[model samples]
Target: MRDPAQDPDESGFGFPAPLWRAVARRRPLGLDVRWRSPLRGPWLTSVLGLVLLVVLPVVTVTGLLSYSAYGPQFDQAYPGDVGFLRLPDFDWPTDPPWLYRLNQGLHVGLGLVVIPVVLAKLWSVIPKLFQWPPARSLAQVLERISLLMLVGGLLFEIVTGVLNIQYDYVFGFSFYTAHYYGAWVFMAGFLVHVPLKLATMVRSLRGTSLREVMRTGRDQTRPETGPSHGLIPTDPDPPTLSRRGALGLVGGGSLLVLVLTAGQTVGGVSRYAAVLMPRGRQPAGTFPVNKTAEAAGISREAVESWRLTLTGGAVEVSLTREQLLALPQHTATLPIACVEGWSTTQTWTGVRLRDLARLAGVTEPSSARVESIQESGLFRAATLQGNQVDHADSMLALRVNGGDLPLDHGYPARIMVPAIPGVHCTKWVGTIDFEAG
Candidate 1:
């Protein structure tokens, strides 16, 4: 009997015989080469799938929470709000101010860790990208489309997220909008792809043990059993890496990446261990700053002349720094958590915003628009919700960590509302325009 590997027509299986014969005759850039390694099969794909299935949801939830931290209640209030889903007024819970810090740290940390798994998963089934007669049926066509969406969406999101973390913007589109919408797109694809591959993944995982999988170098089933099995040519290549070795390398790399970058968010020992953090080590001061006063173009003269202005229904008051200091002082230890995933707690001292509201004649301010002296930027001004303004810890902070606030730490004054994102903690605060209830 002739060898099936040398007979394209006989071995083509579900694919068109003519296409297979043509492919066999051509040696164009080795694109027709199929991966026959047991490592590049459903077994490995299932392993990677299990890992991703666990991590992706964590990423998605944290991402949504970060977006929500931008004051979803003020979604329509700001022209730059990127959240498409105008979720109802929901203040990210503030009781444990470190809540945002924990969530964002997990988001960034887990995101970096998932990189190796995603790459390994893609490598495991890359042959499917070049399969003969790409779509044999309607189901196959839909599966291909869903896979395309999943792959493309994940790549887009991961790239954009990394870029944002490094403060790099190579794309023309808004990173916020693209990333926000891309998450949903990726999730939609993920939801569809999971169920479609569930049966295959279960079978692949249950088919063999780790040792057997590495040793056999092929599925346990015979080639005649299924089209996929027949696609593997009889010429078996020697294994370059064992199953355990491959998994170990990927997991180790992911853990290394996590250890190197997680310090930016994970405080204490991990913070020091994250030597590769893009922001560098936390700068000396009350805490690290994403933006500096100089970088924001606020002059010393502006700081000297800065006065806290308050206006709302039947209330208008402008208080000098001395006057603000004289108003009943309050202090709160709060964490400054940025969207980029770094956070540090500071002992903030200043007058409560509610007191300022009352000083301006409104006993109970529903909302307050905190404006910065910086003149321009996305977060130069932020709307403080009623709950945030009324929170006991809410205040316009002046001193930090028992000393005068550093210039980079929002000198003179800045908003310090609990359970809010760092960006919303408007720095260089110059005005507090309370909204009428």
Candidate 2:
């Protein structure tokens, strides 16, 4: 039997308040006891980690936009007939189909990185809750409310994020859409959380080094004094750094494992690749085509005499569509992601964007512009700045999923940009001018 007088938390994992108090004051066990950055070094690293969090959605959005905006392959693989009821206007692909497997993999991999980095930063600061200093009463209440909001929002995001990763559905909705929408919520909470954290960091860094204070042991008995001391309350006796360092190392390592392994386990690289083109099958044609092109009001002849222009700030001259195709045709199998949140893997045969840049008298492929003809009848342009077009993974795609140009997709030629949004992968064969920008 446990002593009822001694245990309060009752979990028996650690000593209770009475025991700690006895240790602190050399008083009886019936009593209670307690103890506890210049925010710069640790806080700087913490903020960098936060910045990485912001980049997560940016990366996902870029990749999705690259594939979805155009492609006959995308239409055939995930038909629009299965559009979501809630977002009826948009096509939603949530089945664990091959393309979805890989798309979800990237989504979950990026998310796994978010969990640990956030938790480590949180752990470093939670102890200071007790060390919280006296503020204006109203200010303190508001600060407390803000913290609660941050915590609540973080919990909601993390829970939903983890569940989605595990292929678990919470509400009666598709995890993909829910996860994307939840990301905005998480981002809102994150934006709110940053200012509060900045305030905390300012308070933390306003003082002398925490190491110096702890070394002098001056913080063990009294309230901190001077701007060097700032707002952290002095504990009667605080815990040591040795344990904290070990715990931080453990937490950081766990996060790293999650980050590196995610691309393999969750992203579905092998399966997506296999399904989009399949194995041991001769490809059917050079471009993605089907009946969908007619339905979309696109014509079959639009592909003939297709030209890709290359001109930009980096180059003194531009090349026309004929000059580009005459250069050399390079090909590879790459994945495409749509803004509507679906993806497909296909074999793309084309002249490498780099090769075309070189033939166009471009000594530097870094500064280039590729334009896409959108369904809205407006051209969408993206700069291949600073070795972007020259990148080995970026190409002018003429074939998809082991087949010829299907009319709905850019028939004679298209662009394929790997590891970015699908929007960057323009469908129609057009002029890509190489110039410095």
Candidate 3:
């Protein structure tokens, strides 16, 4: 409906003017401007937004870096539903072996740590969601739409990510695909939201000081006087909690979340404190198993018949477990890091991938597809870029820490690349096929 106060003779043509008037005249209970929440104000929202501004970019950039680490250019990343949306082509680096470890750790850890701030920020500005007129202008309408994406996309990403971390998949969708797409959706809204709100956040925070907020009590708690921005209430009730208390509640919750979840990323003794993180619950000694052979549907009978097949050009060699062990063995210390935020580094003794490539007469191979015996799941196979294939530290490990690979740890053979994501390591290796790009 056209606001007669602003356009006395204008008409809201082609719109449901009467229906909108009905909604505006008798607003929904939640949308009522008289909402009596003393803590809901621009100041609270800006503070939370300020925190998010400082951290959300880190989470987002690392999330992208985490995805990029999978080598989408080589078609080795998890199967995201749409291929066109893939990141720009580039050769992922192979040095600083801990690259993926650090990227993934920050991605998962900071994503979880920022939840309380996100929730508090949403709570602070929820009143804006129920504006009576809904959209005052075309620009406002578009902003509201972006806001919808921002909130919905964020919640979807967070819930799916957390559920995946817990190994819970009640949603019945592939977490990798959903999270990958949802991140882009969230980023779209986030990019639009930041510039729109940056000025407001700065304006709201201009005169507010940390010292002033801490000293204020319920008696002093009040909405900042000025443009309400739909957050300030027309009829605020007596404060049930002081501003400092509210800030502390949100800040403390974030700290607690950081403590519990950061341990998974930090690993070692602190891992014991990560009760909620599955990978951290048990220490990953020399052999840390993310998925056991049994869980992966690998049975004793399966590995008993397991044979490593190497194929490239005119060479095709099938080797039994003994043959692989008989080939020269090399040991390298590397970390096995998973996307679920747990990692362990240990000595791995195995056939160098480059050596295995030469055994197949596949020198200068453009790529290598390592397949596993596991009957199902995405990890059953992974393709490695030439860089990953040629990395001297990359290998097909037959033993770990001077012992045979544990059945749960890929018994016969498993691929281990210094910086590759654990899932791409291709555990329970059954075949290695070299490709010419």
Candidate 4:
């Protein structure tokens, strides 16, 4: 069924082999069936894939867990499209106060660490990307589709994640929604690729450990000859670097990137070294502020006359900050972890959430919504599951680090829920509407 022209060049470019070679010799990238990179082979690609197996799962799991910490069941679920997958509807644990901090730190840090490996893996498989005839059969067609998804989805995720952490919004869409959906897309492709390539990866690495491959010197380095994934070039150029040098270059670059940026995740003196992290080199106060009172448009007049309104009670009760302070005050040390990956732990003094619920005549409340005084913004309101509302450490915070909350630190009143995302803590809280079952 193959046409004579299709059999000649097989690139679907319609040019015969001689003409194709003539045209390709003058181009930046050619349709030549083989590449000339001596350091690239199945051995290299498998090495990078193995590294990703260890790193990518941590990033993916923690990233999904970060979203779960927002209490998606209580109207805080972002992206709202609950597609083919939805995280379990359960109360995010509150026992470990530093839960979100550790989870997000690993997510953001490991995410950065995987970049070099991905790049190296892509480089090793460049010849396959330009494979002639595109697909020879249905299986090849399916592999090509999955490969496209794997590469494209991951590239999109990396771009969005990097720009988001830097507070750059050039993407012109909601970072939260787009990144959330994009993660699912990448994961779909990633899942398909792993099973399909697991056997090939294992075969390529059998008896050929990375250390053995890396020990090869420039003089001994030769183009791979085996038909391992069809990546071995037919006409390889002379070696520019040994296999050892290539692996070292990629490994060294990845290690360097991890060391420079991971300091922010651990915090303290190490954080000072993570100058590349925007939040790591933040304010010298108790901790950095996500949004200043000025930015949230908080007015001094409103602060002076601030009243926390408790609704869904026997009687709607409004209390001034001083009056609320008169009630039994409790203190809890909790970490406010942001989705952007920076976290700070501070001791907060405030009225217990259960007490507030009682005041609202909703003892043993099913759920509650905390509304901010900001008037408008995605973060202005957040709904909390009953467990979050009733947690012993959950409070409407009035002070931090034994001092009155600063204007930039959600002064006057803020909700501090154990193990909650920072944004969902609902800074400058003006109202708490309780729901009784």
Give the lDDT of residue 175 in candidate 1. Answer: 83
- Residue-level lDDT of model 4, residues 1-437, one tens digit each, is 22222254444433244554555455545565557787777777887888887788788889888878876666576877565466776778876878888898888877877888889988898887776555554445666787777888888888999898888999899987888888887888899888777766777788376677767789898876554566777778899898888888988988887777777667767777777888667686568778888888997777888899999888999999999889999998888888877787789999999999998899889889889999778788998888888899999999998999987888799999988788988888999999995
Comparing 1 and 2 on TM-score, the stronger one: 1
Candidate models: Cα lDDT each: 0.75, 0.48, 0.80, 0.80
Model 2 Cα displacement at 220 (Å)?
41
Tally clashing residue pairs in candidate 1.
0
Instruction: Compute the lDDT of residue 334 as modeled in candidate 2.
Output: 68
Deviation from native of the Cα of residue 146 in model 3, angstroms:
1.6
Cα lDDT, model 1, residue 383: 87
* RMSD (CA, angstroms), candidate 2: 15.3
RMSD of each: 5.5, 15.3, 3.8, 4.8
Off by over 4 Å in 3: 1-23, 29-34, 81-84, 215-220, 283-287
Error of 3 at 433 (Å): 1.7
Off by over 4 Å in 1: 1-29, 76-89, 209-234, 284-286
lDDT by residue (tens digit), candidate 3, 258-374: 888877767677777877667656634444578888889988887898888999858688989888888888888888888876677778999998888888888788889888988
TM-scores of all models?
A: 0.86, 0.41, 0.88, 0.89
